[model samples]
Target chain A: MKNNIRVERAIHGISQQQLADSVGVSRQTINAIEKGRFVPSTVLAMKIARYFNKNVEMVFALEEGD
Target chain B: MKTSFLLPNKCKKLGKAIFVISAILGFYILFIEESYADGFLIFDSWQAVKNNIAIIGSLLGLALVAFSKERVEDELVMWLRADAMIKALWLSCVLVFLCALFLYGGIYFYYLSVAQYIVLLLYIFIFRYNMYKHIKNNEE
Candidate 1:
């Protein structure tokens, strides 16, 4: 799965730490998600999307191999 | 279950301290006596004690290190911990199965008592150490 977390963070002019705090996770989790090293659980995906005020699909998407 | 699953990251310092103490005691037991004239069986008493010390200390240290929270207890960090544990246990089971042929015979458990504990510690160390290295190296 691919995620637009980094791009979204940039768009919001927020640091990774800020986003992490907003979603109640650590910055490393966000970084891992952005790099595709960790896939968020459904609750976490919704939380992130909710933070960004975007649909879950807008924040996360399927890659060809995923 | 999750609430009691791990100690906070601040406890890693305690883990490190215990590891150092264990290492020191292990070495002390190993080298405190040497009977060149007695050959391998020279200090059998000390050797047994050393092995026991090694087993307990290593297990304690490995458990603390493996279960303690990371500096950042994010989903990925939790995942990594779980990943290391699963991988370690899988490899350990395979090794123990293979070694059990010799490690556990009838009832002569003490013959190679240290083998199982050492293998467990090695598995935990190898998996977690490499996983942590990967995480730190990939930090962007």
Candidate 2:
């Protein structure tokens, strides 16, 4: 899975901590998502996307191998 | 993430204190007291009581530490915990299998005794390491 969470955060001018707090998760989780080290569950993905006022497809996308 | 069957985050500190205190007590009772004794298997009534206390305390402490919730029991932490548990069980099983194959006599029995607690210890170690890496990777 690939995510443009970093880009989204930059565009929104929010730190990882802010996003994590808004999504009811830890900052490390936001970092992991941005780094593609961890994939969020459906609910979490939806929450993150909703936090950014975007759709899930806008923040996350399927990579060729994923 | 609706974490179930996990102790509250505060339990971690209490569990850690219990583990450390009991571990030190166990070490003192096992090694220091044994050194003054002539042979093995020499347990008086008080010694037996103290030994049992140490064993039970350690077990309870490890259980608390192993099952306590993280500060934020989010999905990622839960996933890391589950992953660590699976890895810990597999590794402990392998350790026991190797010990069975290569060890015998009293030493084998010693390791077998240790096998009871190794799973939880390994779980704690691996989970904490993963958490450390997770946090470190995010450091600015």
Candidate 3:
């Protein structure tokens, strides 16, 4: 999966820690999602997108390999 | 996610302290005291009793550490833990198979005794290392 969490965080002018706190997770988790090292669950993906005031499809997209 | 199955985060600290203390005591008993090699493996001996205490303490400590929750018990942490456990099981299986093929006699029994605890130790190391790497990579 490909996610533009970094871009959304930049648009919202919030730090990873801030977004993590808002979404009830650690900053490392957010970083992992942004770096594509870890894939978030549906609930977590929805929470992250909701935090950015966007739909999940707007934030996360299907990669060719995925 | 529901992390009710894990021990409280504070247990991690207590677990570390217990593991360290028990490990040091176990080393002293196994090496300096030379209890196991004295041929007093029988349960009636003081050495046997002390050895059992050390073994139980170490096992308890490791169990606590293995099962305790992370500071932020999230889905990512749970995923890492499950991944580490599977890796640990596979690694331990390979080690046990190799030991079974190459070891025999009293030495093989010794290896078997220690092998029981290796999975927990490996899991803790792999999980903690992964968590460390995750945090390190995120540092700005």
Candidate 4:
């Protein structure tokens, strides 16, 4: 339900806009995901994971409440 | 995953132009020309003209709002649309059920369809705007 996208982007030394452009999504969506205000779909989550060259589980994790 | 259901974002511009122009024409024929105060809800020449214009123009506008792609069409946008559609269907059903008790068959059918279309179009924009606003405010 939450993501470490901010940390991932920080590790790659890229801005949210750059990440969004890479993932074919809006920067606001990236921001929302990072803030835990929204959850991305499986396709989007996979796309984000692929962009980081990491496993999907490594990028997105389930919260205790979820 | 890719979905071919979406038109390019440019379609939204065309949709908006159609909606505005037709809306103006519809309103001009409907109210501004004072084509009223004569018949007993009859479909006379002016009434036919007004009805055709208003119904067709609004239906086009509503379809635009319903079908046109978002400026940034993503999974979240799709989810928002699905949510709006589900809620609109429920709300429109409620309206039909409530209105059916008080109205007859012919008018009931027309009113139900209009209610559904209006609810769906209005909620699509309203829900998306509210979600966008919420995200914007949260970012700030």
Best by TM-score: 2
Chain A alone, TM-score per model: 0.93, 0.95, 0.96, 0.95
lDDT tens per residue, model 2, B48-132: 6667667778888999999998888899898889899999999998998889899999788667556778999999999999888
Better of 1 and 2 by TM-score: 2
**Residues A1-66 of candidate 1: C-alpha lDDT, one tens digit per residue:** 999988988998998889888887777667778888778988889999999999999999989987
The native-contact fractions of the candidates, in order shown, are: 0.43, 0.81, 0.71, 0.62
> Which lDDT value does model 2 have at B86?
96
Models 1 onward score TM values of 0.70, 0.87, 0.87, 0.74
lDDT (Cα, 0-100) at A1 in candidate 2: 97
What lDDT would each prediction earn against the true structure?
0.69, 0.85, 0.86, 0.73
> How well does candidate 3 score on lDDT at residue B59?
86
Q: Write the per-residue lDDT of candidate 4 for residues B56-132, one digit (tens) a residue.
A: 76677667666777777777677777777778777767777788788888677556546635674667666677667
Off by over 4 Å in 2: B34-45
Clashing pairs in 4: none
- Provide interface RMSD per model, one decimal: 2.4, 0.9, 1.0, 1.9
Clashes of 2: 0
- The segments of candidate 4 whose C-alpha lies over 4 angstroms from its true place after superposition are B24-50, B98-116, B137-140
Stretches of candidate 3 exceeding 4 Å from the true structure? B32-48
Output the lDDT of residue A28, model 2.
83
Model 4 docking grade: medium
